[model samples]
Target: MAKPKSGAKKATPVGKTGAKPAAKKDKSSRLDLIKNASKRVATTTTKVVKAAGDAPAKGSKSAAKKAAPEAEQPKEKVSEKTAEKASTKKSAAKAAPAAKTATAKTAPAAKAATGAKASSGKSGSKAAAAPAVPAVEKPRPRATKLPPPGEPLTKREMEQLLTAGEGRGVMGEGSLKGRLVVLNEMPNLVVVGRDKRELTFLLQGPDQEVLPAYVNHKVSVSGMIRKTTNHGGVVDVRKYSAKKPEAEVVEAPPADTEPRLRYLSPGEVSMVTAAGMGAGIKGFAAVRGNLEMTGEEFVLVVSNGGTRQQVSFIIDGKAAAKGLRKNVGHTLQVMGVVDKTSGWGGRISAENVEPRPSEARAVSRDEMELVHIEGEVPTSVDVKLNHGLTVRLPEQPGFTWAIEPTVAKRVGLREANFEPGPNGGPATREFFFTPRNPGTFEVEFFLAKALAPGLVDRSFKINVTVKP
Candidate 1:
């Protein structure tokens, strides 16, 4: 046999040639497959490494197991080459899980960072959507500009101003009447009405300059008015006038004709007499009598020329002040209204008193020998014959003073007059007596009721000496 080529198989024996050729052919095909697989292993290893790197973390372990079998098959065919490749594949398979683990760990960090960014973005959006706070505004004072001096404001203008300044102040035209005064160093007008309702207004305008002169005087003004506050306002006076209070006038009672007379009833008489003289009567009459003033009041003794009975008349103080005292002892004609009347005497509110010529001579109070005693008296009293003794005692109601008949015959009671107490206090009764003869007698005075004379409220006994 010739020398065999390295790549070709040796010639086989003639009887075994067929089997040898078949075996040679089988070996040659196997070599070709090994060559092809060697080439594919490199490509597949690259593919497996890439797939391992790309696989998810959950599938990494299964992908490494499948690559291990593929690497082992190549290792059996070519131990040297496949062993190196197998180790490479095994390392890649091992690195696949490590890479997956690293990716898994890094994934949460990236997600957390991304979530933080998203939350920050959401907060920024909320801040942008929120409403901004508004700034507070301060209150401004009302404008006090006045209208030009001319005709009063028109009705429409006044209404508009009032409506605009409802809670504040407004200026308009109106009239006011009140007393002008200075309050709080500012001139103001005060109006006091019925039921204690009062309104005050501050004064403004040119007329306000003269407000001091019109203090306490009634003032009437017409001009623009401005209300600065709810309680009061201001007045821009255009025209104003002040007036002083007038004096009151009193007219005297009419002294025309004398008033008509009304007689007193019996009950009225008793009451008047008990209160003593100077009591008021409800009538008017005219009489001519002698005017005599008993220091307390004026008495008109009407003798009627000694023919008629003597009657006493108490003259009103006001009438007596009207020149009636000038004719104290003269006969006078008195014409006036009668206030009090009784069977014995009465009171006169004289309207006029004039002297009248008469034949009967009137005795004057100064010319008569009269003795006056008041309050307490001595146990013994002396009186001249044909002289008058006047005794005044406190007047008690429902009582009268009386003397014994024997004492009365000697010392006669001329008359009894009543003098009203000062300032409406208790009254007094005056008893006048004239002695008829010279004698020393015990005189008893008793204050008792007219109907029941025995019931005496008081009594007094005095020894009286009558001298010639």
Candidate 2:
């Protein structure tokens, strides 16, 4: 070689440099390699973005590292231009997680929108598959009209009237005649018409206070009447009057019908006793007393004018004896012939034995003259013989009235009775007497215990004269 130009450098021998200087890479070829690496980085970044959205967020950095290696491999062989492109690819790989975050945020909203459309479509299909139903009609009730006030009610109308108005009674104005009676402690009227049909009315008015006095008497009442039931009603009495019912008259039988057996009169009985039939009296007498068994005979203990007398009964048959035994301790009336064969004590051959209606018959106030004496009397009180005299006084518990034996003989005690006080008050005792003989005598009474007559609580005395 000629002498080199001034700017020209000489080439080193290959053997002396040990190795030929590496051939300078072509810029275009290096550019091509960098571009290809950029393409691979972009593809890998796209794959990483897709995987980051499906996989966990921690894998994003690892994906970036893998793509970095591909971008850095080209840097060793590339020029400045290749380095710049590789830097761009690395930036894109890092941005993939951000893009994946944005995709995750919008996913739930898109899914909800799709589910709404599917549910609406399903509801529409179900509604079209169902069937329709028809509605039913109901019946209405008719109204009833009442008849005029003055017109008479027909049988059908009467039945309807009774069944229709319950609790609210039908009003009317009429007069009714009935017998006033007391039922359930309330005054009610019972009416029996010509057909003998009875109708009861519960009386409710100002006259209710006086209705009790008219009980069991015929009454005529007129006012506003309310029919509560078919057979009963309520009466608001404006005017009322009560009357006593007339007594029914029974005709006597003919005199020749039959001769009835008659009992002995008081005068005839006394005459027969005064005749002195010692052997056996041929007369019938009725004796009333409590039957008692003495020895083998049944004796009737009779209380006559405060004097007790025993009359033995001669029972005829076993049936009569059994019947009289059942009546022991009970007051009985025995009617038979008197046999005076046992001296003064007479025995009755019983013809019939019957129980008395009551232990003691009630004496009528109109049949006898009554004389009332109370407390103590110094002067003699005149009284008619055989008339009743009553001594009334306040009673004491556990004490009884005792009379002198001599005074009791002359003034025989008929009965001793007790009258209960009204409204739970103190009670009173009454001693009834009839003078057996006409004489002036002093009657003394002591209120004392029956077992101890000497211990007296109180005493009363009275002088009485009986006129024949």
Instruction: Give the top-scoring candidate (lDDT).
Output: 1
* lDDT (tens digit, per residue) of candidate 1 on 220-331: 8777776575445777777888998567699776798665566555544344334233345565456676665444467776631111123456788456784565565567
Model 1 Cα shift for residue 390 (angstroms): 8.1
lDDT of each: 0.60, 0.58
Give me candidate 2's TM-score against the actual structure.
0.24
lDDT of 2 by residue, 1-468 (tens): 588879778877777784523323443454466466555545655564554444433454455446446544543434445445553455444434444453344344333444455466668778888756577665332212222234333454433323422324556666678899988666788877322456777776667767878988999987666667766677777789999988979989898896454555564344333322233444567766665443345655443221221123343433357556566556777777654443223566677888976555455556888999764443467889888888876655544455655666678776655444456464565678888688887877777542234567877678888899
Instruction: Give the clashing pairs for model 2.
Output: none
Span of 10 residues, lowest total lDDT, candidate 2: 303-312
Per-candidate TM equals 0.25, 0.24
User: Which stretches of model 2 miss by more than 4 angstroms?
Assistant: 1-357, 362-365, 376-379
